[model samples]
Target: MKTLTLDLSGIYTAVTPQSIQAWEEKSNQYQQQLHAGTGLGNDFLGWINLPCEISEEQLSSIEEAARGLQERCDYVVSIGIGGSYLGARAVIEALTPSFEAYQTKHTAPQVIFAGHNIGEDYLSELVAFLRDKRFGLINISKSGTTTEPAIAFRILKALLEEQVGREEARERIIAVTDKARGALRTLADKEGYKTFIIPDDIGGRFSVLTPVGLLPIAVAGFDIRELVRGAREMKALVDESVPFAENPSALYAAARNSLYQAGKKIEILGNFHPRLHYIGEWWKQLYGESEGKDHKGIFNASVDFSADLHSMGQWIQEGERSIFETIVSIAEPNTTLRIESDEANLDGLNYLAGKRVDEVNKMAELGVRVAHIDGGVPNIRIVLPKLDAYYIGQLFYFFEKAVGISGYMLEVNPFNQPGVEAYKKNMFALLEKPGFEAETEAIKARLK
Candidate 1:
């Protein structure tokens, strides 16, 4: 209900009733295609949600499992790649600062991510840092045959065994892999390891809100219920189209696609708030991994305005016309930051005293608009009233659904990563076997 009332059609007078109806119709059609959108199920859009598929008991079980991880292990190394890792990392970074992962007095246990890559130096460092610490591994993969995480798992498991003893190590480890079988699943069963399902309906990228995300969030002591509830609210609202501005997610997706079709090739996801930088990263991966093939869509990149203004801001203002930025600018705050008065009026800075951050933000946004319009740049600003577990839940789901629709519109498979496969094949050929002899020979011939 609260979501159905928030206004957010920036620069426009108000959202139209007709517009809302169109979005509702789209949502209705999408509900049918959600599962069909990917090889997994309907809500498999980003491996998020099961549409009342998972029970409260299951959520509790995941919460308990996180506790188990905390109890038996000093750290957890999550081994997943692409969506598998990015979604969880988004939540982690959004809700918890990177510094808080391993510090603070009341730590919910430490987690260090590994196995997403196979660089020996990186793996060796993780192995070295975690040598004597009691750590468990939550190895994620559908096939269990993936090169990166699999290699990292083997190395980490060996180290875990040495530290906790193999039997104890097995107890500490958990496998969120395929239900029926995979190399990871088989190894987990043989080792008598703890288990969690990656879900038959959910894909790795979209699995964050499911056990995939729940495990890490619960393990980190975050309010997992709030997060899921937020997503649930988001899903419910996408189905309703009343009050045009209230449906922030639908409006955003549609407008973005409109901009892309108009020859905009880059989306700069800028946020004044540094905390939401990962929302941009999540967006980058979602759009980049989803629609970046065949050169059919705009490239998505992220920037924090105040910080990047010092570096990449110049080209954005004066460079060749290539981008349409989607700025996720929040209007309201979750909490009030005082606009404290300046007692000692240092420079002529007293004019800025007692101005609410929201006020300062208002002026900054106007400047961007003036500059962008003058420079012939199109901008679609995503204005969130506040950042909370629920609103972000809506935001993430909205983009994931939009990306799927955009891909289908592009006549491409948004779910599958055929292009990413090339890199993986090269990696395996180089790492597992001797090398890519033919490619190498070609290179040598070129040199000669």
Candidate 2:
């Protein structure tokens, strides 16, 4: 099978081969730390070997649980924030038919998301819509007390129970949370919801290959096995023994870091494919939370091409030179649609007739890269053979590995996200949640 490849030819204008190679020793040292479990946030390194560590029994269990949900419900709501929901959502959206939302039937439950936000109208409409549909819930959390997903689960669990009764609802709900503790695990044990463990060693953002991501992608009717195979392929290639020159993860880590050292502070993940919008979202969370610490990580952002070409395009082209782009370029599109000739040629696109839409899009991508490179933005192109469960699997693992190497090279722990709690503290204080009396008083004083 063909694996993903990295093209750094466009980046030499900003950083040379020697510059990137300079980090090889340091990058490999951190890579060894990751393998030896001696790095910062080592407790969460379960994900480092996760693609290989996954057992056949676990795969069967995840698939069986997915089948159970698919057989029972028309829709499955995956509830969680950050890594919990993003990984599954990214893979599902990438593989699912773009028009599946308009389809009347599907092979598996149409997976939707909740608990990632606290928007009133979003949940209201979701509840009202599911009132008549046979829907299930996948409540994902380590502690079932994280405010967003907790509130969503509370409302949705009530709805499901009212629709099907608590006993039957238990059959429909799956809780992916702590193995033996936390509120979600306790409720799952008491209520008898089929459960999967979010291994204590793996953090939420990196938990995609685990039950947290696989179950939902499986429930969405994609091949979890192929996904795992792709990830395994990447896992082998990124092993510490692989030389840095031939390793995609190490090369990516080195190149991006070289660019960072050259004063490019923001890393924009741009994709030409529309379905990849969520992939960018997933990438942002993965890199942002993993590396955005100690005030030294790259500011991660994402853009959808051709569309963002109209809005964010201008700024990216002529804006500050502090930005570099990593474009996820798909070599072959999964489907094909040709542009037929118009009789009048009114739009002057006749020259493009007989061309596949993807061909045009690829040109737009190449054109943008040329323009951006000329405009002082360095570009890194990650060419995927095609966008399938397998290659998407490869991409996920590739990014996960690169971020770890990149984070360690920057001398920060990639596994933990300490900065995420700042907002949660303030939000809890303003709401006057118990156990936060001091915070509440301090926040109230500041507000006054």
Top-TM-score candidate index: 2
Candidate 1 matches the true fold with a TM-score of 0.85
Q: Which pairs of residues collide in candidate 1?
A: 34-42, 35-41, 35-42, 46-206, 47-206, 47-207, 48-206, 230-390
lDDT of each: 0.69, 0.93
What C-alpha root-mean-square deviation, in Å, does candidate 2 show against the real structure? 0.9
Which ten contiguous residues of candidate 2 have the minimum total lDDT? Answer: 103-112
Q: Per-residue CA lDDT of candidate 1, range 104-124, in tens?
A: 454666666777777899998
Relative to the true structure, candidate 2 reaches a TM of 0.99
Single out the weakest 10-residue window by summed lDDT for candidate 1: 6-15
Per-residue CA lDDT of model 2 for 91-144, tens digit only, reads: 999998899899887788889999999999999999999997899999999999
After TM-score superposition, what is the CA distance of residue 15 in candidate 1 from its true location, in Å?
16
Candidate 1, position 242, lDDT = 29
Backbone clashes for every candidate come to: 8, 0
What is the alpha-carbon lDDT of model 2 when measured against the actual structure? 0.93
